[model samples]
Target chain A: EPEVTQTPSHQVTQMGQEVILRCVPISNHLYFYWYRQILGQKVEFLVSFYNNEISEKSEIFDDQFSVERPDGSNFTLKIRSTKLEDSAMYFCASSVKGAITEAFFGQGTRLTVV
Target chain B: AQTVTQSQPEMSVQEAETVTLSCTYDTSESNYYLFWYKQPPSRQMILVIRQEAYKQQNATENRFSVNFQKAAKSFSLKISDSQLGDTAMYFCAFMKVMNYGGSQGNLIFGKGTKLSVKP
Candidate 1:
């Protein structure tokens, strides 16, 4: 019953500022993913990482967003320049096996850009 | 592009009554998987149920059950004897059958239905 854990449950930042949300995925899970959910909107996929590299990313993950597994246990999403639209709940998910398997999500990081 | 559709934006049911959340997905892939997740006020996404497209039988987990009609592209979740805790935003998701990228399954989520189960 291990779960993915994210830090800074809520964060507020100004426009043009840089922000990094951290996550510690389930220890034994191999695949990691980042998703964003704007207020009253559907959850949107941002990126997925495996084998220490990005396997897939969406258009929303343009130049502003990047993900890295800096260490064995941590997965981080860095936003180079925050925009008003970037405010949302960022969820980190991990699966024992990629897309076909059930992915468990973290409590989520609420990022608010002013 | 694949789309997961949840036509109901809001639904209400009295405690102990049954409620069903409808979902329909558009996917060309013959093999795939469907999932239903619940996000309560805490905003944490919790898995509710899952169904494999290839399976003819519906998948049920305790009070949670799914009516998966592969031909109709429908996967609905039913909460039997709904409880107050069942009030939340429920989302329907789609996952590809093949995960060449490995254990990380990319999911396509629906707009979500805000369900209110009153006591």
Candidate 2:
């Protein structure tokens, strides 16, 4: 079955440096999302993208965070300056339809900021 | 806003026994979707099952089934004849249907319940 695919299974970056996480959603999917889970914490929603623009975002998705669909197939999330608290597992997901359709998740990218 | 709650933080079951994980949600929207996702030690999120709020007939996938009570706002997952492979952290999530401009599909997830199956 087709699934969401994320690049760089694991990444370690400096506290003040920038990092980019990339995802390639299923070809036919229309909706995409980004979520993160801190160690021993609940998975928190970051943002959702559709039609090549941000559809919605959470408080956790502040100015430092940005998402782009540079190419038709590639969706990327960029963090301007990483912090120690930013360390977590970031997941990329997509659904064929909107809310009612079941979303499929990628095998997360583990981001470690030191 | 919609919220999903998984009261059980951890649970254990014998290899051949049955286990149930509890989940409750708060949502005013009559049309929505509920899902059960499994994350094993590998930390890969896998969709185990899903149920539509409007469907009265509980959804079942082999040994896995759900008891969805629309009136009580409850959706629970039951695993029968559990196997060691079933050991994982299970999360219950809720999604509200929205078509408003600039606001669309997003999932509100619970804290998750860690389940360990003893051999």
Candidate 3:
């Protein structure tokens, strides 16, 4: 089975520094999403991308956070200025259609902001 | 807005016993989807089961099954003959359908219930 893949398993950056998390969604998937889990907290939705554009985003997704499908396979989440609270596990997921369809998730990238 | 809630913070079961994780949601949309995802120690999200709101019959997959109540907005997961390998954090989520055919919808997840199966 095809699985989502994320690069830089772990990222440690200082506050105010820019960080970009990359992921390769399932080859045939058309919908992509980004979610974050703060240490010992509930998973929070950030944004969803489809047809090469953002379809929906949660309040947590702000100007500092942006997503891009720069290439067919590469989907990225860029944080313009990281904050201490940004330290968490960032997961990238892809689904063929939407919720009705199973969404496959990557191992996740642990981003640590100091 | 949609919100999913998993009341149990933790649950345990004997290796050969069964376990049930509870999940409930608040949504006005008649058409939506409910899902159960498991995150192990590795923190990888694994799809455990799913049920459509319109389906009155519960969905079952191997040892996993779901009791979806569209009227009550309740979706609970049942894992029978549980094993140590079933230890993980289980999350309940809700998603509503959008414009496109199965267009991606935002997910609202519960705090999650941690399950530990002992041998």
DockQ per candidate, 2 decimals:
0.72, 0.62, 0.78
Q: What's the interface RMS deviation of candidate 3?
A: 1.3
Q: RMSD to native for every prediction?
A: 1.4, 1.8, 1.2
Q: Residue-wise lDDT of candidate 3 within A2-112, one digit each (tens)?
A: 899998899999999999999999999999999999988899999999999998898999999999999799999999999999999999999987656888999999999
Candidate 3 falls in which docking quality class? medium
Fnat measured on candidate 1: 0.79
The C-alpha TM-scores of every prediction are 0.96, 0.95, 0.97
Off by over 4 Å in 1: B99-104
**Looking at model 2 chain B, which ten-residue stretch has the lowest summed lDDT?**
B96-105
Residue pairs that clash (backbone atoms under 3 angstroms), model 1: A97-B103, A98-B102, A98-B103, A98-B104, A99-B105
After superposing the true interface residues, what Cα RMSD does each candidate give?
Answer: 1.8, 2.4, 1.3
Please state the error at residue B119 of candidate 2 in Å.
Answer: 1.2
| Cα-based lDDT for every prediction | 0.91, 0.91, 0.90
Which candidate leads the pack in DockQ? 3
lDDT of 1 by residue, B34-108 (tens): 999999998889999889888899999999999999989999999999999999999999987664533347799
Query: Tens digit of lDDT per residue, candidate 2, span B16-92?
Result: 99999999999999888888999999887998999988789999999999999999999999999999999999999
